[model samples]
Target: MTPKEYLEIVHIINELKDTPRHCVTKNNRIESVAEHSWRIAMMALLLEDTFSDVDIDKVMRMCVIHDLGECFTGDIPVFLKTDDDRRQEAKLLDEFLDTLPEQLSHNMRALYQEMEACQSREAKIFKALDKLEAVIQHNEAPISSWEEHEYDLQRHYAFDVVAFSSWLSELREEILQETEYKIQQEQ
Candidate 1:
C-alpha cells in the first residue's frame, strides 16, 4: 500500500478510540468503541472452549470489525437506529473499506457481512457474546447509572442473546437477576 493510503487507514482506525459506547451508565465513564471491540475480541478468544466448532480467528475478526462502521457513523445505540440510519452506516462502511488495501478490505467486508447475516454458527455465537458483553458492562457499572427506560431496553437485548445461544442462558439469567437487584436497591 502507498504511504498515504496506509496513513488513511490508520487515521480512520484511530477514530474508534474517540467513539464512545452509547449505553447509559451511572458511572458517567463511557467506554470507547476501540475498547469495546477489544473486549469482544478477547471474549471470543476466552470463550473458545465453549464453542469448539467455531473458527476463533474468524470470530475475533468479526468482533473487531463489527463496529468499525461506528467510527464514521458514531455509536448509534441499537435501540435508536432506524432503517435510514442503517443504510447510511452501510454506505459509510463501504466507503471506508474502499480506503484499505484490496485483500484486507475484502476480508474485512466479508467478516462484517457474516456478522450481519447472523446465520453461520460463528456469527450467531459472536452476536450472543456481543449482547452478553454489553449487559455484563452494564451490570458492572455503578447502580442507577441507567435511566428507567434503559432497564427494559437491556432486558430485551439480554433475552435476545439467550435466544441466540443456549450456552449463554445461565449467564443471561444471572445478568437479569443482578440487574433487577440493582434496580430494587436503588429504589
Candidate 2:
C-alpha cells in the first residue's frame, strides 16, 4: 500500500476518536468509541491464556475493528440501537473499507463478517469482550455518571453473549458483583 493510501485510510478511521459512546470514564468523562475499542483489544490480549483454544490474535483484530462502523453513525447505545441503525453503520463502514488498500480492506471485511456471524470461537470471544468492556467501564464510573436505566442494563446485558463459555460467564458474574456493590452503595 502506498503511504498516501495508508494515511488516508487512518484519517477516515480517525473519526472514531471523536465518536462518543454512552459509557463514561472514571473521571466523569464520556468515553470515545476509540477508547472502547482499545479496552476490548486489551481485554482480548489479557484473555489469551484463558481462551487458549481460540485464535486470540484474530479476536484482538475483531475487537479493534468491530466498532469501526461507529466512525460513521457514531455510537448508539445497545438499548436504543435499532436494526436500521445497525444497517446504516454497516453500509457506511463498508463504503469506507472499500476505499482502503486491497489486502487491508479484505482483512477488515473478513473480520466484520466473522463478527457478524458470531459463530466462530474468535468471534464469540470478541463479542463477549465488547459487551463486557462497556459494563466494566460503567462499573468504574461514579454512580451518578450513569443513566438510571443502565443499572438494569449492567445486570443482564451480556448474559447470553457470554453463555457459550463458562469462563466468560464467570467474568460476567464478577462484573455483576461489582455492579451490585455499586448499587448497594448508592442505596
Candidate 3:
C-alpha cells in the first residue's frame, strides 16, 4: 500500500476510539467502540475452547471488524436502530472499506458480511461473544447507573446469546445471576 493509503486506514481505525458504545447506559462512563471490540476479540479467543468446530481466527477477525462501520455512522443503539440505520451503516462500511487496498478491503468486507449474515459457526460464535461482552460490561458498570428498562433490555440480550451456543448460554445465565447478587449486595 502507498503511504497515503496506509495513513488513511489508520485514520479511519482511530475513529473507533472516539465512538462510544451507544447501547450502554448514558449515566455511566461509556466504553469506546475500540474498547468494546478489544474485549469481544479477547472473549472470542478465551471462549474458543467451548466450540469445537469454529474457526478461531475468523471469529477473532469478525469480532474486531464487526463494528468498523460505527467509526463512520457512530454507534446506533440496537433498540433504536431502524431500517434506515442499517442501510446507512452498510453504506458507511463500504466507504470505509474502499479506503484500503483491494485485497484487504475485500477480506474485511467479507468478514463483516459474514458476521451480519450469522450463518457460519465462526459468525455465530462471534455474535454470541458480542452480546456476552455487552452484558459483562453492563454488569461491571454501577448498578445505579442503569434504569429498569435498560436492565430488562440487557437481560433479554443475555438470553439471546443462547441461540449461538449452549456453553455461552450457561455463561450468560451465570453473568445474570452474578449481576443480580451484586445488585442485592448494593441494596
Q: 1-187 in candidate 1: lDDT tens per residue?
A: 9888788788888999999986534456888888888988999999789888879888888888888888888988777899999999899999988878899988888888788888998887788878888887887787557766778865766576467567678778888888888778878
Q: Cα RMSD for candidate 1?
A: 1.8
lDDT of 2 by residue, 76-150 (tens): 998899999988988898899888878888989988888889999999999899999989999999999888889
Ranking under TM-score, best-scoring first?
2, 1, 3
Task: Give the best candidate by lDDT.
Answer: 2
Work out the TM-score per prediction: 0.91, 0.97, 0.90
List the lowest-lDDT window of 10 residues for candidate 1.
22-31
TM-score of candidate 1 to 2 decimals: 0.91
Cα displacement (angstroms), candidate 2, residue 61, comes to 0.3
Screening candidate 2 with a backbone cut-off below 3 angstroms (N, C-alpha, C), the clashing residue pairs are none
Higher-scoring candidate on TM-score, 2 or 3: 2
